[model samples]
Target: MTTRIDDTALLIARALIAALFVAGAVQKAVDPGAAQGLLAGLGLPQVLVWPALVFNALAALALLIGVAVRPVAFALAGYCAATSFFHLIPSDPWQMSIFVKNWAIAGGCLALAVAGAGRYVVTRQRKL
Candidate 1:
């Protein structure tokens, strides 16, 4: 049925999104100093580094496991929005390109939040 196919597509999309989050989180976790520097470059306060690292890791884990996916998606979307706001503004064309990339990712996260992870998510089965 069409619904089943859509579910499969959503599952794949969710997995991909999870992978992105996990990779980013892992990178930050493995190199806190580097992550902090990156955040600082984005104009974020130093106090934000640890929280961002922890939240990113936690959010990625939750997404990977499909647990509380709606909220996770919402949070991720918010995170992306905040990043876009801070880092995506007042940049040259080259930097603007990277900012646009974050916009696209933020759009995807917003879609996930709105769609509630589709039928393939554990949250749908009340597993989380």
Candidate 2:
């Protein structure tokens, strides 16, 4: 049985996660040069920025629509974990906060993957 609270929590989680990635995509779209520079600084090839931007946008859209929620959540969780180690993690305490937050976000995604999309999602998982 699905509780009201569970449905609400899942919706909120999906929305928040989608919004974060969408915002990131918008930032990358608005300042491609800066995005490329940042990626290059992290030792990533600048050419990868365009594809990453598209991936973020598409993944955000998928999350928002709640289609293929589990797989998307797992992929985003991995992406977040990777970005935390490469882009966010730093020696300074202030910078470490962002790193910690990325891991927290990844943890949330992992939870979402395990929980599925609840009753509110568009896509329904089949029971075996």
Candidate 3:
């Protein structure tokens, strides 16, 4: 049911979405002290930051390369929504904006989940 432009649009969307995850991973990697402290303050284990770093890096690459995009997008959607809580403090305009953006990203991921990666993926998707 999709046209070529739809597939191309999906490809571009995937890249843009993946870029966000890449930036997140890089930020944590480059500044673990801050990331670790933030997680610790949230009553999460500081050690959890490293695994998160790995997940973000791998997931970003997988999404960017269009590998298992449906599953990855679903997972990322959940991840985005869950992490959004960290920025849910409405008193801070900056945090509120991030929380809203995370929800928007989650919505986009859900769309990708429904649409799949289309034809331009590392593993070509069959028209269904």
Candidate 4:
């Protein structure tokens, strides 16, 4: 069915988006000092680094496993937008590219939130 195929496609897209965050979380966990330094440079407190790492990991897992998709996607969208403005801007070409990429990712998250993980999600919220 066309709907079934579309749902599968959405599942794949969710997984791919989650993968990027998971990989980034792994990198941050592996080299937390670097993450801390970067966060500190952004004028964030050092204590917040670990929480951010944990949030990233949890959000990525939720996205990948198709649980609470809409809220998780929305939250990640906010994160992406916030980071793009706070951390990625006012930098070199590489960071500019990342800024643009974050916005694009945020846009995808917004779309996913609206789409509600299609039919591939663990649980579906029904209309009242």
What stretches of model 4 exceed 4 Å from their correct place? 89-91, 123-128
**Error at 38, model 1, angstroms:** 3.9
Candidate 2 per-residue lDDT over residues 22-113, each given as its tens digit:
98899888988877876788888998878888989998888888888899999999988877764454567765886788899999999999
TM-score of each: 0.77, 0.85, 0.91, 0.86
Sliding window of 10 residues with minimal summed lDDT for model 1: 119-128
lDDT by residue for model 4 (1-128), tens = 34988899889989988998998789878888876776788888877767878888999889887899999999999989987864565658877888899999999999989887777767666899
Best candidate, TM-score: 3
Give lDDT: candidate 3, residue 6. Answer: 97
Worst 10 residues of 4 by lDDT: 83-92
Q: lDDT values of the candidates? A: 0.73, 0.85, 0.90, 0.84
For residues 1-128, could you state the per-residue lDDT of candidate 3 as single tens digits? 78999999999999999999999999999998877876877898899888889988998899888899999999999999988887888899998999999999999999999999987877665898
Residue range 25-125, candidate 1, lDDT tens digits: 77767776765766688767666767876787788777766678788888888787777654554547765775777778788888877776566655443
Task: Assess candidate 3 and give its TM-score to the true structure.
Answer: 0.91
Candidate order by lDDT, decreasing, is 3, 2, 4, 1
What lDDT does model 3 reach? Answer: 0.90
Candidate scoring better on TM-score of 3 and 4 = 3
- The positional error of residue 120 in candidate 1, measured at the CA in angstroms, is 2.2
